[model samples]
Target chain A: MMHINDIDTPSVLIDLDRVEANLKRAQDYADMHDLPLRPHVKTHKLPEMAQKQVALGAIGITCQKIGEATAMADGGLTDIFLPYNIIGTSKLDRLVDLHARVTLSVTADSTDTVAGYAARFGAAKPLNVLVECDTGAGRCGVQSPEETVELAQQINDAPGLTFGGLMTYPPRGNIAQADAWLHKAKAALESAGLPPKVISSGGTPDMYRAAEGTATTEYRPGTYIYSDRMQVAFGVGTLDDCALTVKATVVSRPNVNRAVIDSGSKALAADAVPAPYTGYGHLVEYPNAVIIALSEEHAVVDLSACVDKPLIGDTVRVIPNHACVVTNLFDMVYLVRGDTVEREAKITSRGNMR
Target chain B: MMHINDIDTPSVLIDLDRVEANLKRAQDYADMHDLPLRPHVKTHKLPEMAQKQVALGAIGITCQKIGEATAMADGGLTDIFLPYNIIGTSKLDRLVDLHARVTLSVTADSTDTVAGYAARFGAAKPLNVLVECDTGAGRCGVQSPEETVELAQQINDAPGLTFGGLMTYPPRGNIAQADAWLHKAKAALESAGLPPKVISSGGTPDMYRAAEGTATTEYRPGTYIYSDRMQVAFGVGTLDDCALTVKATVVSRPNVNRAVIDSGSKALAADAVPAPYTGYGHLVEYPNAVIIALSEEHAVVDLSACVDKPLIGDTVRVIPNHACVVTNLFDMVYLVRGDTVEREAKITSRGNMR
Candidate 1:
């Protein structure tokens, strides 16, 4: 085994023990609720880590893109759910090919998307389509219960496609709204002589507050595996549960109150804003130190609180503002156990942004 | 030939014709100045693009990391300059290996970094070291010309290293300060009976404004190849010269004023700060619209001014805030000529961050 110091600076380090602990915690929550846990693999994007989640009794995995699902399928994790609308012929072709190799299900919010998937897969390789309901998170999916039923009915009638379930990712404070939306959509589906067998509803914030009795049979939470500063800010997970961190070296100490690290927007990632984040990222060793600013190659961290300030060569670990985007910034992750690097895993699906 | 529409969404599209034109413009500037042009390959890490620069009469290519330089050397580019401080044992080992493979030169400001490199090289393969004088960039490098000379003397006397030259990335509007510092440093070196050879200077912002008779024989500018929103904000290039743009699909129209694109931080990158600029990125089609915010998977563009509103399935292109960092976000880039897809080239050194 290589020593932790032997790897490289500005590298992504994952504590295997902490990751396992995090996985078990989420698994325990799912077990307690009697909900099928489909851990979203977007957080790690490494096959080895995904396999570990499967070993911890995950039903399968969830992916955001067909490219990621294909990578996971190629890595031998056969069951995958892509909770994003699969649009365009290029992506649909890849989806068709992936469905041939794996048990694949995708989300749809419109008749056009459902019909496109059905036309591509038309009874040849039937795709499982989940009706994505927009409970609160106003990103994608159907707006109302009526639209959900209309899309579900279209999926049921379309050739080579099976309407398997209802899926949604609600806003953090609105679990009740998600439950209400799912209930109405479920009732509408049943009244139309259709039943959703797999009702998947989850986001990291609302996963713990998930209501199982209200048409949700499975939960898909990606960030729960390796919660970040964003999750911590949202009250999703404590700082101790953050499994991955960017180990950076202090490259410049130009002033008494501030220092610059080798990790900048390129290393820590630029997904540092969109509400509660005060700066670029959070310093793991120095929690009080705020990353006041960032350049493409330098991160300006204010280390005014530390009694013994970080010097020009000191190494510090940083938990990025958002973990999922940070995961896509690296090619490999060092799995560390104490002072030893136990393994190096390729971020095989790191840049699969199709 | 793959049609332009056949490519997947959220993928990097490079206008090859525009890229060639940009390259020719930079080459013409270098010729007019009678200075060697070292195009920084950190913008586009593709070997083919680096070769194209070399074919267009660039002296060499500059890389920020040793891993990127090594990849370039492996791909058959012999001359390379690493304009970053090389610290740590793992990086030192790679630098030694790279020096053996190519005509390698690196920048350092501190004696500790220079000594580390010198000790590793050990006279067997003497490494060329350039003293980096801080000309108000406030990032790295020596602050004073006297300090630069002291560091240079240490490198000159070191058994395994040769003091090659002086380099500084001066802040914009402080070109005179850079000139004064380099002049004083050059005088100091000459007084010590050690005349430096390669006086490297120039950043993209100060490329056109580089002062004459500053002993700068070679100028390195990376972003001149594919200018971005920052360049436009800095009044460096027009939108027509931006060779790269993210071809994104309008995935959701949540409200009348805003529309969300599939390209978010993961695709456009989060290095969208630092400038006379506002917003996350610049929309190519709707130039007036502000990219109000960004999530990991979504970019919210405020399109209130456009007479024609974007639909859920409309495709738009975004010129990212920082083009260089954006290039590092993908594994491959599609080279396009007008509406035609020309070729697909691997970003060979995309994640080489050792």
Candidate 2:
């Protein structure tokens, strides 16, 4: 074990105490709502974290890609759900292999993708398929509830696919719209005699306001484990709930008001979303100063508002705009408590962009 | 060998033909100008790429962090220049250990950073120090030419430091100003009987426009190897010269005019700088359509003007907004020649953010 002061600069520190508390809080919410909690492993991507979540009474785990699912399965996670459309012949083959190792389910928005999955896994084992509906995000999935029923029917009729549930990732402020869409999709599926058994819906922003009804049987929230600046901006969690931070050193104080840090766009990630507030990212301890801008290897922090200005050798921790993307930036993370590094966890599922 | 069509989706494909051509082009420019080319390894961070650059007649390699330089040295690169200030005690200790392993040189702009280096490496080995001068970048380094000389004298008087040269990374359109500053700084150092043996000026955006009589003996440009959307936007390179691209699958055609890809901010990096371009990244083959938005695992591409729309399973390539950050996003890259994968290279030097 090492103290926080002893750890090297530009390292990722995760407060295990906060993480365990977050896990229990989310699990208790799911229990109160009588829904299975399938937390997305894409956030932490650590096997130990996944195991901890499962130990805290999560029904299973959720993944956005086959690579992430495979990584979770390799880490002794027996039940996994990939909530993204798995296309192409090669990826379908990997899906079949993953299904052989664990209880696996996947999402699809089109008949072509469903057909591919059926062709690959219909003979060996029926592939569990969930219809991905676009409530309002405008990113992926089927547009209408009618399309969702049609896709579910297609999966039911396919030789090697089974209609499992309905899934959607709605826009942040449009939970009402998502509730309406999910209810309508559930009705359509039941009318077609193919009602989804596991209706999943949740994102970090609207997890608290998750709609309760027959349409939502499970919730998948990834970012609640390590809330970031984006979640703070969206009013999801406070700064104390943010479990992860990138520890960086102030390498140069070029002027009185400005300083350059070793952690830049590469380390912190350059995901500058339009927030209600200013700055590239928020400093964890010193909230007054903002990360004004970032170069490739330098983060220019404006320290004008702070009462105690950071010197050239001072160390600071920054919570990025998005925690998931920041986890992908590093190969490993230090699981820490106060000042002691309890363990060094490898981000085994990182860079699994397949 | 794998053909381009046979390779897996979301894999980094580097065109060796274009890479060789780019290396030769930069070499020719440096040869014509009689300036040593020290290509920054942060763009690729591959040992083979660095070897190829050396084979193409590069003097040495430049890295932004100590971990990168250590990885390069472990890959048999003996000489390395880190163009950033070294401040922290732990990092300075590692710098001394690295100096013992290889020929290590670093840049510093302030007396405190210079003193840190002197305290660490002054007794065992004289630290090769370069005075970093601020030439309109407004990021780091000293402000004026007189300050550059004063810092140089401080480095010289320090017990275990040697003032080897001067260095600066100027903004794109201010090469003339940087040239004037470096010229004055060189005169000041000479008048103080401490002329620099190596003067380095770098920044890919201003590399082609480097002024004459700047007293710059070396030029460091990192992104010239794999030009990106930002480079193209800055009028640095054309689409034909871009050697790296992300091969992504069109997972969803949500609407008639929109297609969502498997690659998003995690794979492509969300460094959406120089806005009004409106995208996390630019489409490689289809230049008309813009990647309008990005979620964690979905890249929303707007295809309103695309005459021939991509199908649900079709694969498309994307050039990220910034190539260096994109390099750090992936773990491996496929070297290609005319649609055939020649070799798979591990990005071993990635994630060295320490």
Those runs of model 2 whose alpha carbons end farther than 4 Å from true positions after fitting are A212-214, B122-125, B273-276
- Chain B TM, every candidate: 0.96, 0.96
Estimated TM-score for each candidate: 0.92, 0.97
Model 2 lDDT per residue over B54-97, tens place: 88889889988888888888898878899999877677878888
What is the C-alpha lDDT profile of model 1 across A1-354, one tens digit per residue?
Answer: 788776668899998888988889888887877887898888899877789889988999998887788888878898899888777777788888888898989988777678778889877678999988778876666888888788888888888899988988777777777788889988888898888898898778767777543678998888888888888888877888888899998876655777778887778876754466688887877878888877656788887877678876778888888888888989999889878998888988888888
The best candidate by TM-score is: 2
lDDT, residue B234, candidate 1: 76
Poorest 10 consecutive residues by lDDT, candidate 2 chain B? B205-214
Q: Score the docking of each candidate (DockQ).
A: 0.46, 0.83
List of chain A TM-scores, every candidate: 0.96, 0.97
How many backbone clashes can be found in candidate 1? 3
B-chain TM-score of model 2: 0.96
Model 1 agreement with the true structure over B1-354: per-residue lDDT tens digits: 787787778988999998999899878877887888888888888878899999999988888888788789888899998887887777787787788889989988777787778779877778889988777776677878788778888999999989989887777767777777778888988998777788888678767766463678888888888888888777777889899989998876655777778887889886754566788777777877888777667787888877777777778888888888888889999999988999998987777666
Candidate 1: list runs displaced more than 4 Å. Answer: A123-125, A212-215, A252-259, A273-277, A311-313, B187-196, B212-216, B252-259, B273-278, B288-290, B310-314
